[model samples]
Target chain A: MRVLGVDPGLTRCGVGVVEGVAGRPLTMVGVGVVRTPADAELGQRLVAIERGIEAWLDEHRPEFVAVERVFSQHNVRTVMGTAQASAVAMLCAARRGIPVALHTPSEVKAAVTGSGRADKAQVGAMVTRLLRLAEPPKPADAADALALAICHIWRAPAQNRLQQAVAQHALKGPIR
Target chain B: MRVLGVDPGLTRCGVGVVEGVAGRPLTMVGVGVVRTPADAELGQRLVAIERGIEAWLDEHRPEFVAVERVFSQHNVRTVMGTAQASAVAMLCAARRGIPVALHTPSEVKAAVTGSGRADKAQVGAMVTRLLRLAEPPKPADAADALALAICHIWRAPAQNRLQQAVAQHALKGPIR
Candidate 1:
């Protein structure tokens, strides 16, 4: 399956597209960032982000899109932005009828580095090794995006199973 | 100074603009959202977002932009989209040489409700009351956008002071 992984940030959003099939390693198709200025109108900045994502989607045309979920603490402003960003991704995927998946940081880290608490540097290192890259991915955001895609490929079955369980649970009125 | 606040999202990203002076309440000029189709291509949706934001900017030009910073946790896919959306906002501002400021969630909540733990409903209520609106803001995102603008106004002094301190700290480091 072709998958697109994203690492969201207001200033710098990273994107990576990969194509892979069952029992096959994923191949990198594209990776880059959408950046906004430090000084600009909020509406305008959001517009820029929308345009960048659109460009990436047009260029990559991945079948599935993956993104990181927000688990913030004690920061409403940050959380709001995160929620907003998340909504945007969902909207983008939904608009195109593409299935979107969300992965936790720990899940991605563990899938890539075999450690749930791996830091950015460690995760980057593992992604480089797993992908057998000549050089480590530049800018932490890009590396994170790549790792997210890997996590989806590695854990696709589990995720599908989990979704089924959740659906079943919901139908049964919450399994307490 | 004039400040614009954005509550960025995919389906609907809210934008609010306000004018502020020292020790004075910020005046609201405009508030609205950019709506995108959930079933459209990413590029088309982004184009819609860009057009929406541009229209807002053209109607009400604010001097500064305040956006909520995005922080991700579990869902990498979602975070990536959020990051891209945010990049759009930043890029729009940067292109016009407008100053952009990012605020954490807590800071915004604290500024609006005097409590960082306030929920979305609470924040929305407060924003409506503060703005003396005839009715509650249509969508939750719009209310949050207005709140962000208010938060920027209230926190401007502290932010400026913090920036100065950081600048001073950096200046004290060895010159390169």
Candidate 2:
């Protein structure tokens, strides 16, 4: 399966596409950053991010979209912007009928590095090795996006099976 | 000016429209809430909000759109949802080329009750009085939205003139 991962942010959003399945080597299809000027209006910035995500979707056509979930930050203002950017990514995927998954920072780190507390340097190194790249993707955010894509590709199969099983059980009829 | 005010929320988003100018009697144009099931997926909830806001924009065609600026709250999850909803509102307005403004809770309270520290009841009572309504709008969220509309109508003029002055000054060459 192909996955498009988004590391959502107000000033710099990262987009990465990975093509692979569990227990297989992944190939990097595309990677880039969508940057918006901090001085621009909030609405304008959001529109820019939305357009960027839409363009990526059109180009990559990934089977699944993974977004970094917004978690608490000491700086509330920054967190708010991150959350807004995350929402814009989700909206763009929903508009195109693409399934979206949210992965927490720790979840992504653990999936890539086998440690939920892995630092940026460790995650970067692991991502490079996993994708067999010449070097780690620049700006860290881009690498993070690739990491999310890898995490989803590895995790989603089990999740989908569980959901299917639940649905099938429900279809059998309600319990008395 | 006619203003569309949005009280952003994940489960129940309050929307209201009011028409009037500064120092003039205001009239209520519309008021309603857009609710999504609590168990709905995050992306689905956001799409519901987007559709609701789009419908409001198309139907009312208000001159201005006012959204509640999310502030820090104890509940991080709740705050994130609010921020997401707020973004969707802004996105809908920006897509339509409609001017949008964000008003803080304190600003709305101050505009309606002459006190930034005014309680919800005070703001609601004042909204009813200013709009010349027979009773306060039900579900405090609706009243808060109307207050935001009234606040923007009263505040935007001065803000717009200030922005225009800055732009004009910039065009006349840089100040020494």
Candidate 3:
């Protein structure tokens, strides 16, 4: 399976594409950042993000798009921008009928580094090792995006089964 | 001037269009709410918001879009959705090169009711009176949207002059 991961932010949105499935070696397809100037208007920034994300989707054509899930509990000032940027990523994917998945930061860390509480350096190191890159991707955001893509590819099978089970249960009606 | 105002939310995004300038009676061009199912996935909800906002823009062809400024200090659960929705609104306008303006809740209230702390009812009442509506628009969101359009109409003149002054000042040498 091919997946595109997005580490969303207003100033610099990280994007990474990976091709693989669970229990297999994954190959990195592409990785980059979408940057908007800080001095631009909020609307302009969002428009720029939309354009950048669209360009990625157009080139990669991944089966799924994975984005870092935003939590309001994070830094009060930055969380809003993160949420807004993620929304744009999701919207772009959804508009094209591409499936979008959100993985928590901890989930990405745990998936790659085997620990939910791993530090940035640890996560970056693990991502480098897993992707067989000579070195880790820069700016940390790029590494996080690859991590998210890896997590989604690894987890999607079990997640699909769980969703199917729930749907089947719903069809069976309430358990009285 | 024609302005489309948006009271942004995931479930119920309110929109209104008003025409005219400050010190003259404004005319209500349109008013409505765009709703998405609460049970839908977050990505789907955002897509619905984008479609709704785009439709409004296509129909109204307003010169500007005025959206409520979201604050992280608001209810944590809802604030993220508000910010996301507002981002979509701004994105739609900016993509079309229409200017987007943000008005805070207090600013909207103060512009219409002469009190920043005015209750919802007071703002609605004043909106109805100013628009010469038979009654206040239903759902506080819709009323607030019209209020935003009016606020922008009244404030845009002074805002343009201030922006121009700042631009010209930059062109000249610093005061020091």
TM-score against native, each model: 0.52, 0.91, 0.91
Worst 10 residues of 3 chain B by lDDT: B167-176
Q: Give the TM-score of candidate 2.
A: 0.91
Residues B5-117 of candidate 1 have per-residue lDDT tens digits of 88766577888887775476557788888777766434345545656766777778877788777666535555544554665566567667777788877888998899999
Candidate 3, residue B150: Cα displacement in angstroms equals 0.7
Predicted candidate 3 versus true structure: per-residue lDDT over B47-67, tens digit per residue: 999999999999999887899
Clashes of each: 48, 0, 0
lDDT of 3 by residue, A34-131 (tens): 99888777777887888889999999999899999888888988998999999999999998888899999999999999999999999899989999
Q: What is the lDDT of residue B136 in candidate 2?
A: 94
lDDT of 2 by residue, A1-176 (tens): 88999999989899999998789899999998999888766776787788889889999998789999888665776888999999999998887778899999999999999999999999999989999999999889999999999999999988767766888989997779
B72-136: candidate 2 lDDT, tens digit per residue: 66577688999999999988876555667888888899889999999989998999999999999
Model 2: how far is A175 from its true place, Å?
A: 22
Candidate 3 collision pairs: none
> iRMS values in order, in angstroms?
11.0, 5.9, 6.4
* TM-score of the A chain in model 3: 0.90
Estimate the TM-score for candidate 3. Answer: 0.91
